[model samples]
Target chain A: MSETMKAAIFVKPGEMTVREVPKARIEQVGDAVVRVVRACVCGSDLWYFRGLSAHPHNSQIGHEAIGVVDEVADAVTSVRPGDFVVLPFPYSCGTCPVCRAGFESVCPHGGYFGASQAEYVRVPEADGTVVKVPGSPEDYDDETLASLLTIADVMSTGYHAAVSAEVRPGDTAVVMGDGAVGLCGVLSARMLGAGRIIAMSRHEDRAALAREFGATDIVAERDQAAVDRVLSMTGGYGADAVLECVGSRQSFDTALGLIRRGGVIGRVGLPHDVEISAEGTFYGNIGIKGGPAPVRHYDLEAGLLDAVLERRIDPGRVFTGIYDLDQIQAAYEAMDRREVIKSLIRF
Target chain B: MSETMKAAIFVKPGEMTVREVPKARIEQVGDAVVRVVRACVCGSDLWYFRGLSAHPHNSQIGHEAIGVVDEVADAVTSVRPGDFVVLPFPYSCGTCPVCRAGFESVCPHGGYFGASQAEYVRVPEADGTVVKVPGSPEDYDDETLASLLTIADVMSTGYHAAVSAEVRPGDTAVVMGDGAVGLCGVLSARMLGAGRIIAMSRHEDRAALAREFGATDIVAERDQAAVDRVLSMTGGYGADAVLECVGSRQSFDTALGLIRRGGVIGRVGLPHDVEISAEGTFYGNIGIKGGPAPVRHYDLEAGLLDAVLERRIDPGRVFTGIYDLDQIQAAYEAMDRREVIKSLIRF
Candidate 1:
């Protein structure tokens, strides 16, 4: 086997490079090393790429991946070598209080994967973090593999939005962003039994996808206009639940204005400079439930993988552009310019 | 038969006077005139007394009362003259979308009972706002009347905190204030099936009341000490639900620190200059649900009145002082000095 691997490393603002790096090895009793099959870019990555947020120079990049396990330490009992697995964005000790409570993403002992966008990656807490696929990666078609990759992040995140909002059967729900997560939020709301789904998107392509994902209405307006449109659509009562996929001040303000008096806002966009007034939420009996998506919980505990294998949801459509490991820069650039909804990296 | 009556008027900060004013009468088709039987000074009333919040120079003061229906417009059918009723702080139109959804406090057509502290109060949307007691106020003893008076505000507000927190059976709950509402929150958490109740209070009198109201433990420490104590008590996992009866920034901070991952904070103290970071909440999968308590919903719709009459809960114990209408100034002064948990005015 080769002692070196191709990996993407963060160089600085607006730059990432693919270079030959040391192959991942089992470093702890709980660690496992996997040869990457697929990985993808995330919207949050743009925060650092645009210099809106800082990224450490020369750090291993990427957090989402699916691969075939090549090595596992003795303590890693969940998966063995040659096993196909999908990694949740963050690794967790499944026995921790937080993971036990189904909030694995925030487990104190857990953290993000830093080298998933590489030929070989080391996974800590492997027994608790990675979900084993039913069969080898080659058994799945390209579309199915793409869909499985979503289970690592976006799809689970969208489902978290719906779950957090407490979307009820036959209730009106709204999605506040037109990105991959927002589109997936529409799909999740539908699966959760929302009777009427409204997707607020200005992009035609995204809007069409939202409709396909079960949105009953499309709102192209922005800010207060969007709030007014939703209110008008719901007979001035507003939606019962709102999925805030864009963690912007304007998005939160719009959410505050466009929900029914007793509604909730499920925010999963990784907030950027967002401050919510306690007084503002108190008057409306509004609820705010959000955070990092517990992808491991959704994938293993909530049967998300089963739903995917059954073809119940095809979230891979968000992967509009595919690239080889060498095209890492182009992938980030295309997503930053909104040229593609998301970019998938094939190993 | 009286054309004029004495009402407490807000003269300025630290000054309230009983002055002769026109007696309350039907002002709208949905109005009812309530002859005050018992009214109380609330913690919120102290906000203006301390000059911390603004009030009109001579507006009728107070928002909580239990009274006998003196007169009603022809269109008011819920209560008739001579019927005893508990006035929820806000009067809401039952038909409004907000009211239908059980949030009467923020109904578009609802408002506070400004003259509730007076000899008579003109209640608008009476049918939707007042919950009729089985008989006249004379039929119940002083203790029952005092408890019923609490159904108007504090007790219901406390219940809102527990309900908002989604306290479940066997869960450990924390109450963040030692005021009447927080004490009642202890009772509410117990009623909601929380196995362990921790009250964060400093005063001996309030702590005693909290225990009587079903607090299993009390943490007299403030700020970080309180947070640390709670974390230690719950095996370092923190409480499952925290009732934020104090809407200060410090209380919210403490709540954020002491809640277990996936836990919730139910705040109902009428937030004063409080702000929550969305990023902070998102990481822990924390949820915030709060607002003005929907008293009418709890009283009529949820059978809180039944619980009071059945003696299942006696929240009246929070009334540590009682005074005649003529002693209004002393009532406010005693409460302002923290000499009483709550002061009741008997008319």
Candidate 2:
């Protein structure tokens, strides 16, 4: 292993630069070193780059990744050298009472990896955070791995929204965004037995993909009109469940208005200083279940990898543009211009 | 039956006058005529009497009662003549799907009884709305029956709040408001298996009853300090469930703030405007389950009668003042002055 490895670092707000940094090494007995195969930019990742987040400057810039286990410490037993693995973005010890209760995302001892986007990453609690991919071809390609990368973060977030919404068979679920997480919510709702999945998207392209991913309907309206469309489609009873995938106030209002009485609203959107009306929610008997996308709770690294291996869900479609590690700024520019659904960086 | 019966009539706001009206006769096939043994005034009834409600003038006031079945219609089979029964305030047919689902308070064919405080009340859907008292004693008295009268309204509202809050065994529940409903909430929480019950009351006398009824703690504070007091008692975790028994905005905020994360807030308070902020409710993942009291859902008439018969709860403590059929105005004035928890009008 080289003493210094290539990493993409956020030098300042709205800037990314490639640099050779000391490769991540096992700092704890439960840690492991993984060689990155593919990593992608997430919508939240953009928040830091756009100066909207409180993240420190010159920090590691990516979180979603699929990699090969290069080395494991004495305490690590889940994966070995040369094994393909998917890493949960927010690493968890996965042995706490909360994790035992299947809420590992909020595990007390969890920490995130890839603070500086490097080729080799150090994963804490490797036995619990990394899931070895099974039955992979000898020469697996980057796109397949990049698509699988999403399960570590955004895809898992979408799945969490679906689960929290209590999407059941013959129930209508409305997704309130068209981003990567929203698209995954469309797929997750279908997988969870939602009879009719409505994806609210203004873009024709995203709406088309949502349809292909099992969205039964697409409501192109926003705000009050969007609520009216959902109500009309459900015979005035309103959707049985609603998924708020966007953190904006408009999306929150739309999700609340689209659900019926006694309905559940699963909100996974991360917002800055968001407030919900107490009286409005109380009178409607609306139940809300969500926070910070409990990525570890869903065991995304393992469950999502199996889905990829079975070809049950194709998340790689989220990555529309790819760039070598040196073209990181160009990748961000394309994503900012909305020219790509997601941009990937290759080693 | 007499040709004319003594009845209490609210001819104008803040005044009640007794008038001779024709005795109520069984009009519907399923109806029964109940000779009122005891009746009580409710806070909501005062709203109408004070002209603060949307109800029209000359509307029959007073919905709580315990009475004897004097006559049964042709189709009536649940109760027979001489049977002492407790009437559910909102008369439900009890055969609709909603009623079948145990939401009888919102029964499609249900409506309130006693257009005027009459001596004989014609109860519609008698088979569904009336519960025959078990083991009638030879010496049946008004005090025992008067306490049982609350089962029809305030007591039921309190029970509904606890049920909607999903108060479970070993959980802490906070009841907001020191009104009759709030005091009843303390009893309901005990019945529902709440390990720790916190009653928020400004009145020391009501707080004492709350404790006697099984409240483990008393929060005399009203505003944000009350919320802090509840949190302080719960080790900063907040109550596992909260009952919003008061309809004011302050009570609403107190209830919302008193509940822990993932806690349920049951709101039975009927607000005039029904307005609440969305931001405060959305982020916490709190669930709310209630609007108007579902008096019919829990078979309050039967349940409360059973409780009374078994000597489990005594609502008579709430009735601190009593008046004749003609002293209704003074009764209202006394209640307004907070000199009485509840005032009963004897016909």
Candidate 3:
């Protein structure tokens, strides 16, 4: 085993570099070292790279990945060396109160894995953090593998949005954003039995993928125009549930405009400068609910892994571009340019 | 009956005068004129009186009341003349889409009853707007009548808060105001099976009433101190659900600080100047759901009317002071001075 391994390192705004770094080891009683098999860029990663938000220079940059367990500490028993696993972004002590309440992402004993986009990643609380796959990495094909990778973040996030919105069986669900999460939101709404899934996207490619994922309608408009179009379509009643995937003020406002009285908004995008006035929401009887995806909770609840493994959804189609460790910078650049819906990096 | 009757009129900021105004009569096909038997001042009414918010000069005031049906249009059949009833603040058509969804408060065809404190109130959509109390006013005692009056607004609003917060058995529920609505919220939480109900109050009288309303604990501290006390009380985990009965920024912020991860906030107070950041709520996996109470929904669903009639709750005790129509100004002043938790006006 090598003492050093290649990893993606944040250099500065708009740049990430792949270089050899110290290999991860079992540092705690419950730690496990997983050799990366797949990793992906998140929309939030683009935000950090664009400096819309700050990121520490030289910090390990990724938070989603799938890998094979290389080692586990003596106290870790959930998985063993050679076991294939899916790593949720946040490492949590699943026994904590927050975790017990199905919010492991915000568990007091949990923290993010900022270094998942690397050759080897140290997973703390391994017994609670790494989800063991039924077989080794080769047990699934490339598409299945990519779909499994999404269970770490985007897909689960989309599912969370749908769940938070309380999407009903015959609801008219409006999804804002054309990104991977939004497409998955379409899939999730469909999975949850939404009668009408409307995808708000201008990009033809993303819109098509959204349809494939289960969008019954597509509105290529933005802001108030989109709101008008949707309201007109629904007899001026607006949607029953709105999945807000873009966390900008405008997106939030658009969401507010696109819901019927007593409708709900499930917001999954990490909000950037959005302020919801309680008075503004009072008259409409609007309900706002969502947060960072508790991917682990879903994994344990309904099994996103099983859904992918069983081919119930083909979310891997979101990876319009793929790359290797050497092409890390290009992956970020391609996604930043919107040249790809998402970039999946192979180990 | 006289063509004119005494009513409370909003003369201007800080002045509400009782004067002879034209008595209400059936104005629409769905209308019913109710002779006021009992009416009360709401905290929001105080807000209107204090000029914190605008109300047209010389306009009719008051929305909570119980009365006898004086007359009903040919199109109305829910209640006949001489039938006792509780009038919800908003008069909604029974069949509107929003009304059918249980949010009659924001029904497009619905509107406020600004003249309820007067001699007679013309309730539109009488079949839907007026909840028949089974018999005439003489059948119930004064306490039951007062509690029935609360069903028109405060009690239902408080119950909506608990329902929105998704209060569960064995959960710690926090009520964020000491006013009538908050007191009712404490009672509502207990009704919903909350094992621990914490009422945030500093007033000795209100605190005692909160205890009587099933508040197992009381935190007189405000802001950070209150948050700290609650955190310590629950082993620094905070309450599972927070009912925000005060819509001020401080109250909302305190509610945020007092909830555990995955906790929810149910806000019913008419929000003043509160702005909630999506970013602030995202990290905690928090949920917010509340609006103007769908009082009619509660009335139709679990029968808040039945709850009062059955003595399952004694929310009428929230009326700490009572007055006649001539003391209308004094009723407002008493609540403003914190000398009374709430005031009821007898016709």
Best by DockQ: 3
Runs in model 3 with CA error above 4 Å?
Answer: B12-14
Chain B TM-score, one value per candidate, order as shown: 0.98, 0.92, 0.97
User: Which of 2 and 3 is ahead in lDDT?
Assistant: 3
Per-residue CA lDDT of model 1 for A209-259, tens digit only, reads: 899999999999988899899999988988899999999988989998999
Instruction: Please give the lDDT score for candidate 3.
Output: 0.90
**Greater-TM-score candidate between 1 and 2:** 1
TM accuracy, model 3:
0.96
Q: After superposition, how far is residue A141 of candidate 2 from its true place, in Å?
A: 8.8
Q: For candidate 2 chain B, which ten residues in a row score worst on lDDT?
A: B274-283
lDDT of 3 by residue, B132-202 (tens): 88879999999999999999999999999999898999999999999999999999999999999999999
For the record, the alpha-carbon RMSD of candidate 3 to the native fold, in angstroms, is: 2.0
- Model 1, residue B43: distance off in Å is 0.5
Instruction: Please tell me the interface RMSD, in Å, for model 2.
Output: 4.6
By lDDT, the best candidate is: 1
lDDT of 3 at B95: 80
